[model samples]
Target: MSYPRRRIIQTGGALAGATLAGCISVSDDSSDKNTSDDGSGDGKTAAGTAQLWHGRSKGPKKNLVTNVETFGSETNHSVKLSEISELEKKLENAIPAGKGPHLFQWAHDWIGEYQPAGLLSDQKENLSVDIDSTFTKAAAEAVQFNGEVLGLPWAAETVGLVYNKELVDKPPEMVEEMQSIMDEHHDPSNGKYGLSFPIDPYFISGYAQAFGGFYYDEGNDKLGLTNEKTLKGFRFVRDELAKYIPKDHAYDPQAAVFNEGNAPFAINGPWFLGSVRDSGVDVGVAPLPKPKGGTPKPYTTVKIWYFSKKMNQGGKNATAGRKFAEWHTTNTDILSTLAEEHGFIPVHKDLAGSDELPAATKAYSKSVKMGEPIPTHKHMSSVWDPLKSAFKKVVKGDQDAKPAFKQAEKTIKSNWQ
Candidate 1:
C-alpha cells in the first residue's frame, strides 16, 4: 500500500460523542441561590457559595479558586472552582432551566455548537464590548459567532518560533533570513543545525496560511487547499525547506534535536515551554517570521469564560453575576495572577506593565494575538488525523505534497461520518 494509504487505513479512531440536552425544568425556590428565574428568588449562589463549573483539577483548580476568592467579596458571591467531569451534559440540562452557575469555562471552538442551542448569551447582552477594548482583535473575534459576540475570551496559545538564543541573537524576520542563517550555521557533523521543525500538517499549515492558503473556506463551507498558493507553499516546504530537516524524522527525534541544541529553531507552541525550559537550554521565543512579508499565521486555541444564558436574567442577581465574570475575566490583577500562577496567556492589553509575566506567557503572547482561531465547524474534528499521515509522507519523499493533501481531503470529507 502507498505510505499515506497504509497510514490512513492503520489510523482508525473514534471522535468524542455529541453532548445532548434534555427537557429538564428549572427549580423554583426563594432561597436556592442559582434559581431558575430572572428574579423571583434570591440571586445568591447555592448555600452562599457561588460556583464556577470547570473540567480542571489539581493545580489549575487551585489557581482558579484563588483568583475567584480575590474578587468574590466584591459582589458577596463566595465561589468555588468545582470540577464537573460531565461538564457538557450537566450544563446542557442546567442552563436552560436557570440552575447552572453564573460562569463556566470552555473552549472557543464550541461556540458554534452551543450558541445556536441558547446555552450562552451574546457578549453584549448583559455586558458591554467596550469593556473588552483591551482584548486582541483575534481574541475578541474568537468569541463571536454569526455576528454576535458569544463570551469573554480568556487563556489562549498559538505556534511560534522557539530558538536557541545562544545560536541566534534575534529571530529572523523573513524566510530568506532563516535560510541564510541555516546555510551559515548548520553543521551536521557537529550535531548543530539551523531548523528542527517537524514536517507535520499542524505546524506547516501555519506557514501555508501565511502564504495565502487554507484547508477550508470559512464562508463557502468547502475544502480550499487545491489552489496555486497552497501548492507553492507545499513545494517550498518539501523541496527547499526539506533540506534543513533531517531524514526519516518523527516527533520524538525532532524534539530531541532542538532540545539538545543540535538544531537551534523549532516551530512549536507555548504548551511545549515546560519541556523546552527543563532541557536547560538558553531559548528565545517570538512570533514566526514573515517570509517575504507573508504572515506565518499559526493556529490558535482559545479558552473562554462563558456566562450562562440561564443564569444572567437582568436582575440584581444577574447584575452580580456579570460583576463576578468581570472581576474574574477583566481584572488586571486577577489576569496577572492567572498568568504567573497558572501559565495562562492573558488576553488583556498592557500585560507588559505587570511584573508577574512568566517566561512562557511572554513567549506565547505575540502569536496568540496574530494567529488564526481554530475553526469551530464540527467537520473540523475529522481533519487532523488524515492530514498528519499525509504530512509524514510528503516530507519523507514518499509522496508529492499536492497529491498527499488531495488524498487527505477526500478522507476528511468522507470520514466525518
Candidate 2:
C-alpha cells in the first residue's frame, strides 16, 4: 500500500451506525443546568455540559461511552453520552423540535439532509483547528456540503477484496484475472465457489463503478442507473461473475464458504475481519481489481462527529462539545485503539499512514481511500431499493441488466416525485 508524503493532523471521533439531527445545547435546554461562566465574561467559551447521542451498539458502543467518560474526567466537563435505539429516526424527529444532542455521532451522508435543513452547524467558523488537510480526501469530501464543512470526519468504511492466502498467493490486478481465478475453482455441485460475493447493490457497486457507472452523481444531482457503461458492468456481474458465486446470494452462505476456506476471494468490508480471523484463515486484504475500462470504486461511508446547529447557541455545551470533538479526532492513541480493536479505518492523514497500523488495516485502507463517498443528496436514499431490486432481477436471470436498470431509473424518479 502507498501513502501520501505530507501528513496532516486534526482531532475527531469514530465509528458506528446512525444519523444525527437537531440538538439542545446548554443555552437552549433549561433542564440541564450545568452551564457556568469562568468569571471572566470576555466572551470566551465556557465550561459546561455536552450532550451527545449515538446509535452505536456492541463493543464499539462501549468504547464510545468510555471515551466520553474519559473526556469528562480530564476536562472537568459534564458529558452525557446516550446510546439511543432507532437513533437515526429519533434524530429526524428530535432535531426539528430542538430536542437533539449538542453533538451527535453518525455517518457523513446525512450532511446533505441536515445541513440544508438548517439543522447542522457549519463547523467552518466554530472548529478550533484547521482540517483542510487533516483527513483522507474521500473522508474530507464526505462531510462537506455546498462548500461548507458540516462535521469532522473520524473514520471511513468501504468494501474490498479479502482473500485466503492458502488459496491464492497474490490478489488479482484486473477483472480478467479475477474471472480466471473464478473459472479455475468454481464447482457449484461440489459446494465450492470461486468467490464469496454478496449480491446486494452496495457490494455490487464496484462492478458498475469500475465501468464508470454510478447510482447517483451528487455534483450533478443526477441518477445514472440506465447509463450504458453501468449497464455493461451489471451485465458483467450477472453473466460472468454470478456463475462463479454461490447460488444463494445471501451474506451468510457466501461468508460461510469463504470462512470455511472453501472460497479464495470475498468482497466485503472491515466488519468481516474478525470472522475470517476466527476461522483461522491467513487472510489478506486488497482493493477490488480494475475492470477493462476503470478501477473499482466502492461506495464509502465516513463516520463523523456532527456539531448540531443548536451548538451554535454557544455556551458550556458548545464549548465542551468542541473540546471533546477536537480531542477525540486528533488523538492518535484513541484512533489507533479503534482501528485495531474495532477495525475502523482512521481518516486522520497521519494515522492512516502510520506504521503502527496492522498489515490488514493498512492494506484495506487502500480500498477505502480509493472509494467514492456515497452520494449525500437526499435523493440518494431513494436510489438504494430500486437499484437493489434491479440487481436481484439481473442476478436471478429474470431480467436483462439494461432493462432492469431502465426500470430502476423509472422507479427512482417516481419515488422522487
**Best of the candidates, lDDT:** 2
C-alpha RMSD of each candidate structure in angstroms: 7.8, 7.2
- Models 1 onward score TM values of 0.67, 0.81
TM-score for candidate 1, residues paired by index:
0.67
Alpha-carbon runs more than 4 Å astray in model 2: 1-49, 57-59, 136-138, 179-192, 251-253, 256-262, 278-281, 310-313, 354-356
Model 1 stretches astray by more than 4 angstroms: 1-66, 69-107, 117-137, 146-149, 179-200, 240-262, 292-294, 307-324, 337-346, 349-370, 415-417
TM-score of 2: 0.81
Q: How many clashing residue pairs appear in each of the predictions shown?
A: 1, 7
Q: State the lDDT of candidate 2 residue by residue for 1-417, as single tens digits.
A: 111111000111112234343232223345334445353566554557777887663456656767877776776566667766556566667777777777888777777667877888776886776786777777777778888877788888777888899989899988789888877888888988999987877788777777787789878989888888788778877876777788888777887899898888998877676667777988888888887867777887788899887676666667777788888888888888888865678989888778889766776778876777777777887788878888999889898888888888998888778
In model 2, state the lDDT of residue 150. 73
Clashing pairs in 1: 210-295
Full-model lDDT for every candidate:
0.64, 0.75
